[model samples]
Target: MLSAVAGAVRFVMVAIMTVVTFITPFLGKKEGKIERKAEECKAAFAAISDTHLTDSFIRLGMFEFGLQDMAEATDRLDALVINGDITDHGYPEHWQAFTDTLLKYDISDNNIMVLGNHDTWGGDRTGDYTKENFIKYSKEATGREIDNVYFTAEINGYPVIVLGSQSDHTGPTFYQDQLDWFAEEMEKASEKGLPIFVFCHQPFNGTHGLPYNWEMEKDADPTEGGIGEHSDYILNICNQYKNVIFISGHVHAGLSNTEDGTNYSSVEKVGNVTSVNLPSYEYFDVLRHGHMVNGTGFVFEVYDGEILLRARNFATGTWLENYDVTIEIEK
Candidate 1:
């Protein structure tokens, strides 16, 4: 009887927290309006990662704010890619909350959500069940017939390919079949002579301050914070293609440059592939190092022979001018 009473009290406390988190955003001061920075933009999109929404209200408020900001940023967004970790755990209620929150805003209908490790970490279900849930919600959100977790979409005639881990692990695991499919997809997309945008939840091995950057340790394992055994395979495939911009978001690293100018930058290039690592979009207190600014993400604008990437703190509706980057694309 005593244990039951304690459980009831805990539930009540959680309920109160959830209610507060949902309402706090409405009461907070609204940030300045967001406007498109690119003129004559052929295609534009916003990318954010590591939302980490859960069944409770931990990051829901922040995610809601982010959606609101993005919705108001421009008149039309070709796409809004949530790179991964859409849920803290793969639970039905968690996804329900995410969809419910999305319905409250005017975010782009062309939403591309990648599957993160946290989305598959729910211990209550089998891996198949978790993937099925992902497919269901993805279809609901994008209005596409998604047979697998990994799929492709086209935004304003630009090819966008998304990759996902076949198994549920801390890092991504790509089997041979998926690798072959990726190669085929790359070949097809490259033939168009346009910049190919690839979205994955995990970064390639050692590109974005891996191992050490994973936990900020200098002597960490080489593969501690990257795609596991298949990292090299994916890297090789990406190298074979020109103008491949790979984006990922599992590290939760900050957008600040490192002191030694080595690891932890938001952007890096390996061979022909340019990798853009997104900071975790959760609350600020959850981050450990670097710029702990929460609600940070990227705005990608495609122009005639160049792609502009501007970092923005959506929570504050401010652009991070120092981190702006431009990539030249060969037509």
Candidate 2:
């Protein structure tokens, strides 16, 4: 009888916790403030990812509309970065749809995109998910020749490094050559005494409170998700830098905290690197606030001493108040 009662108590506790997790977002709302300390000492940008654009006309239409709203909202954005997963499937049609939507909005020139696992058919889907096609469609949509998926560019005079995986799509993998390139880039930025913004499609594994399934199945390879074979190498390289803002996506988790009160879905810091996981612009098994309000993205405003990340739903013109985060920029 004692053992049975103990088991029953445990079950009840789990059930109660689950209920609380689902309702917490409604109980308290968090808001972020944007205070400009200096006019010349700051820049602003916007980011959203995991669009998973499909070939459906309805879906494409919705995305098109959302793009319009996003553009209108961030009219003064210094840069607009679309992190990855531009298409749901590695299909030519899906890519075309995504391109069409961006072109229609006249926001193509403002975007800097990367490739996600979905674009490479890293999941169960199969197709000609080649780098050639990725660049081809990307250029068609943006009207810029992208010879390399990974490159560095200056955003408001800041050295920003963009990274893409050439292997192991779902989880992330950086070949030795890629790692070498990253190290060189970081060295260059460090030598200049400049803060760097690193953008990738996958978040770092294990550090953000993401579950094991995020990287791989429980029984599958232990090294997947954000913690792939080259995670340590990449992270170690990043840690060597002083101020590195690494942003990623792919996990379509919601913008709310999980049942354990962990908001691994948003901003987190490990070592000298601050990692940001942008919430999906589409719908998925959202752990926060049930589902996203569509057209969800973040606006980053940099000040003299800190950065403010404010989450907003362009489709609805409202902010996810509780999801705001402020990171102090290290001197």
Candidate 3:
């Protein structure tokens, strides 16, 4: 009788653990499959930023629009580009949710998402954060080997570079490294007449030739004087290569507007290459993230070498701007 009781207890415990492991993380994702029976194709693709998801919620505001974006993209786009913040924090529930999501979606694992503010930094105990762990989670979840190997991928025929903020350094110094690396890459692109697009976590500069700051100062550049010492090298590099496009989130303003030749407005500099900023869909507290009104990301459609942006209109499903200008790749 004693042996039987012990056996039964052990069996129950094993079953409970198994169920918890498998059954959880079935949240945050709607059931769907890629539109194409085989696969989809397109010339270049749309840039997707700030997914900000993990598993638990049944439904949310941007769910349908995101799905629609995927469907449209799969139908017309050859690949997808994500600008980072893949996990909210690396909680068990969020990680599990993220793992099961890719497994279920049957989505392509070639997506490029950057590590953003939402992801925890080193020594961040509660968030389960750290680039190594984040890399591990992504590799395990998506079944893809990540490194400089996958950073530069060719979608369709165009080349896409996805930059990360959590490498060697997560602070302002990264900007300097990013500038050097970007300049080398841009040199090659310029020689080949190829255009490079940058998707980062923070904006390069604030609107009106200032930085998006923490204190709302008179003359602050988020890239320079906001939190950490701003990276002076980044703007210098971009000034030389104004043709390069920079798109980002964490500012919640539409595309940035700056006279410092850093922020490229779609309206002001529509023809010449421009830089853009995106809005955070999840958190939008005025005097905090935004004024609670305008808070959405910018999406870009690249054709030939011309990149066009779609403003923030989640309701109409016209998220990223459509391609308008024609690109001439001089061979």
Candidate 4:
């Protein structure tokens, strides 16, 4: 009973905070702008994660700011990748809000939706029901027919592959079949000799300060805050390829500079793959280690043989220049 009461109070607080955030633009909050250097790139995309949209208009309004900023930034986004955790509880109402928001913004017709654990968490329905809803809405967003949660797309001639867990869990679980598919897809994507963009909701087990980064628990298991048993298997597949850029979310760890001597930065290179863990697009009080500024994500620009990642806080319309990184795509 106490826990239920605490949850109720927390919800009320969050609702109030959402309202305040929603109206910040009208209250003299200086909106940051993203300057897309279009002439300097071959392909570019905006990647964000953990929107966690619910049925509330205020929360949806908060999300709308990001989309609005992106639309205003570029004439046309080559693609927009929402890495995962799209809905708060995987309920119909939650998804309806997301669909409505997408319709309101003419941001990108090439919107790519990836599955997060929360998107499969059906509050009162079975997991399969929620997964089906994901497929339905994903088609609505991307205009592509997809039967499975994981799929691939070619955006501006660049290979973009999205991965998802077969089951709903805090940490993702990958079955053998999905693992096999991923390997095959990687092989095909690698043949182009261009930077392959991969999106997953959860990071690998130890990258980006996992376990400690997930819950701030010093003694947690290595896999506590990442992809579960198949973590190494996925890493191995990435290692086999050159110029693979892996992006993920779920930890909600904020942006940090590499000089911080912590693995919690927004970007890291594991083997042949460049790993990027995005900050949660919405604010949650559970974040630790500072840098929890909400509305944070990255814009990836592919050059001849290098990929430049620029960090931005879309909510306030600001650029996080300190977290910007440039990675050389291995030839």
**lDDT scores of the candidates, listed in order:** 0.79, 0.68, 0.46, 0.80
Ten consecutive residues with minimal summed lDDT in candidate 1? 283-292
Superposed on all Cα atoms, model 3 deviates from the true structure by an RMSD in Å of 12.5
For model 3, residues 133-175, the per-residue Cα lDDT tens digits are 6567666665546653115555554555555554423332354
> Best to worst by TM-score, what's the order?
4, 1, 2, 3
Error at 302, model 1, angstroms: 0.8
Give each model a TM-score: 0.87, 0.79, 0.63, 0.90
Q: Candidate 1 residues 103-178, lDDT tens each?
A: 7877676888888988887655456877788998887666667888788898888999999887788888777778
Candidate 1 stretches with Cα past 4 Å from truth are 1-32, 123-125, 258-263, 283-289
Better of 2 and 4 by lDDT: 4
Ranked candidates, highest lDDT first: 4, 1, 2, 3
Number of the top candidate by TM-score?
Answer: 4
Candidate 2 — which residues are off by over 4 angstroms?
1-41, 122-129, 213-222, 257-260, 263-265, 287-292
Best-fitting candidate, scored by lDDT: 4
Model 4: lDDT equals 0.80
